[model samples]
Target: MKILITGGAGFVGSALAIALKQNYPHYQVLALDNLKRRGSELNLSRLKAAGVEFTHGDIRSKEDFDALPAVDAVIEASAEPSVLAGLDGTPDYLINTNLFGTVNCLNYALKHKANFIFLSTSRVYPIKTIETLNFVEEATRFALSDEQPVPGVSAKGIAENFPLDGARSLYGTTKLASELLIQEYNEFYGLRTVINRCGVLTGPWQMGKVDQGVMVLWIAKHYFQQQLGYFGYGGTGKQIRDMLHVADLYRLIDWQLHHLDQVNGEILNVGGGLESSASLQELTQVCQEVTGHTIPIKAVAETRTADIRLYVTDNTKVTNLTGWKPEIGIRRIVEDITAWLAENEKDLAPILK
Candidate 1:
């Protein structure tokens, strides 16, 4: 089988490409990336070393896909990814890349008759709705109340049936819009497609930043003895999110490829679930334990408009169908990232620190 991965040089994209190639040497894998993210260019060598072909191209341009050959599948992983994007008065890049670029990818898939797999964001759920969830404050984190006033949410976390009304952020808006488009393509064009509404996905090689990939960002800050801050929810550092290792995601995608008929037209929520969730304070403690650094963290009472206090995926839907669940816990995720950072300190310090 031949595969094309957009954002192929990115953390998730590159990791998926390398894993697929390593596990199935007979499968031809091509990774196309614009390398817009800071540390993405670093993955070119890793991709090549793993026997995955790399192409420097932007999905925003239709002409870029003209040079590529037909593939059996197209993994749409390219996006701006930052929730804070366009708040500084620049929506062009986020919208064009996340929405328009997806359309271009869809066209490419249509032309090739390839199965489409979209990596959508959990941000597609309304922020206001999630904020309304009831929770109790624990010493290190916030725990969801057993009962929720909202549908499709509970202590188990947010489910696939969560209501999708209200503002979720410009970054999320584009992804949700793209999801609608993908559904249309699947219905109208008869393209086989599956959408995974993923929560925080992190692992080694992710160039994490404050706006996204906060798990790795948290570890990186502590690893280098850098100061950190909690900006929302009265600055108590109680905001929480579930994390999924990229390897776990790769396993699911691999299974989906083999069982596309079963998962076709399915929109499932994917994440590490409640078992792998952590609050900022909890993550800080873990980071301190792993990195052996005790850095002071500043707390600000003001909440970012685009920020949500908690988002855990209830993976019952996907788990039942695919029999897949994230095996890596928060500490394990941190350990892996720490190891990667330590191994490549000389090369990563400038970017991560």
Candidate 2:
């Protein structure tokens, strides 16, 4: 099978390409990326070393997709991925790349009769709704309130059916809009499209910036003794997020590819869930324990735009359907990222600057 991964040189995209090659040696994997992200260019060698073909191209341009040969499947993983995008400037680039880029990808898939997989964000859920989720604070993190029983949510966390009613930020708006377009494409053209709303996907090879890859950013900051700050929400740093390692996503994608027929047109909340969640404080403790250092962190009393309180993936649906659950916990996430950063500290010197 010939497969194309958009944003192929990115952390998630490159990891998927490498993992796919290892698991399915007979399949040819091609990755196309603009290398616009600060650390994206670093993945070119990694992808090439893994026997994955690389193309320096942007998904925002239809000509890039036109250059590719017909493939059996397309993994649409390209995006800006910053929730704060467009708040300080125009969101045109985010919309053009994420929403319109999917349109271009769908056109490419239609031409090739290839199946489509959209790597969407959990941010598609409304920000107001999430911010309103009833929670009580503990020593280091927050948990759901027993007084309120949110539909599609429990101690396990938010599910696919979580309410979607308010502004989800410019980044999320683009992804949700793209999802609608994908559904339309599937219905009108009978295109086999599957959507995975993933939350906090991270691991090695991630050139994490402040706006994206927060988990990786946290670890890198701690390991390198970089100054850290907790902004907004009184700077309590109690805001919670669940993390899922990229390797676990590889396992799920493999199963989905083999059983596309069964999972077609399905939207699953794919993530590490409550079992793998942690707060900034909890994360700091772990980093201190793992790296054995007191990483200084400041409390900035202003919250950033579009920042939410807590988000945990409820993987029950995907777990029941495909028997897939995250195997990498927060500790392993710290270990792998720490090891990768230490080894690639020289190569990543420019971005880490």
Candidate 3:
């Protein structure tokens, strides 16, 4: 199979490429990215060294899409994934890169008659509905219901059925728009399209940025000697998040490729579920335990725009459909992130600036 992955030089995209090459050796993987992010070049360089084909191109440019090699599948991983960056009269980049970029990708997919997979985010859910959640504070984290059921088993976490139109932030709006675009393309072109509304994805080869990979940044700072900052503490330092390893997503996409007819035009919330969740305080403690450091913690004045209070995904739909769930835990997440940092410390130096 010939596969083309956009944003393949970024964290999730690069790791997906590595996972595909390792697991499906007969398949040919072509990664396309602008390499605009700091250290994205490093990602592409590493992939090239590993024998993956690549093209230096921006999704915003039509010529880039036209130039793409024919492929059996197209993974639309490209996006300006900074929620906060979109708030400061700068959402155009998000729309251009995410919305318009997706249009280009879908068009390319239809033109080539290839299957499409889009990498969406949980942030597509509006912040108002999440804020209205009546979560209670626990010793280590926040519980959705007063009953405090086990992790990965709460209805309060955003499910695929949640109302999506609750005062979306700029970032959320674009993602939501792109999601619509994927569906529309599927209807209009008969394209086999799958939408995975992914939550926090972290693993090796990620140049974790503040806007996109918050969890990875926290892990990198705590264990890898990078500087760290906490925006809010009064949320009890337990603002919970469901994080999944990128490898798990590789499995999902692999499954989708095989069941193209079954998975097409379906939207699924993909994540670590309730079982693989953590808060700022809990993450800090884990970092301390693993790194034997204080893991400095501080507080800021207010929450960033559209910061969800306790964002976890039900992930039951994907589980039911593909029998896929997170195989890695938070502990393994930290260990692998630390290992990635140690292995690529020299290459990551540019982004550390």
Q: Pick the candidate with the highest TM-score.
A: 1
**Model 1, range 223-300, lDDT digits (tens) per residue?**
989999999899999999999999999999999988999999999999999999999989998999988999999999
**Alpha-carbon runs more than 4 Å astray in model 1:** none
The 10-residue segment of model 2 with minimum total lDDT is 146-155
lDDT values for all models = 0.94, 0.89, 0.80
Candidate 3 C-alpha lDDT tens digits along 1-353: 99999999887788778778887888899898998777787776678876678888998998988877789999888888777856777677778998888888888889999999999988887777777766778898876873332323345466787776567677778889889978988998788999999988887766677777877777777765645666763645778888898888888888888788887789999998788899988888888787666755666747776677788888888888888888998989888877777777777656652
Number of the predicted model whose lDDT against the real structure is largest: 1
RMSD of each: 0.8, 1.2, 2.7
Query: Would you estimate the TM-scores of all the predictions?
Result: 0.99, 0.97, 0.94
Say which prediction, candidate 2 or candidate 3, comes out ahead on TM-score. 2
List runs of model 3 lying over 4 Å from the truth: 146-156, 224-229, 233-235
Model 3, residue pairs in steric clash: 152-274
* Higher-TM-score candidate of 1 and 2: 1
Poorly placed runs, candidate 2 (over 4 Å): none
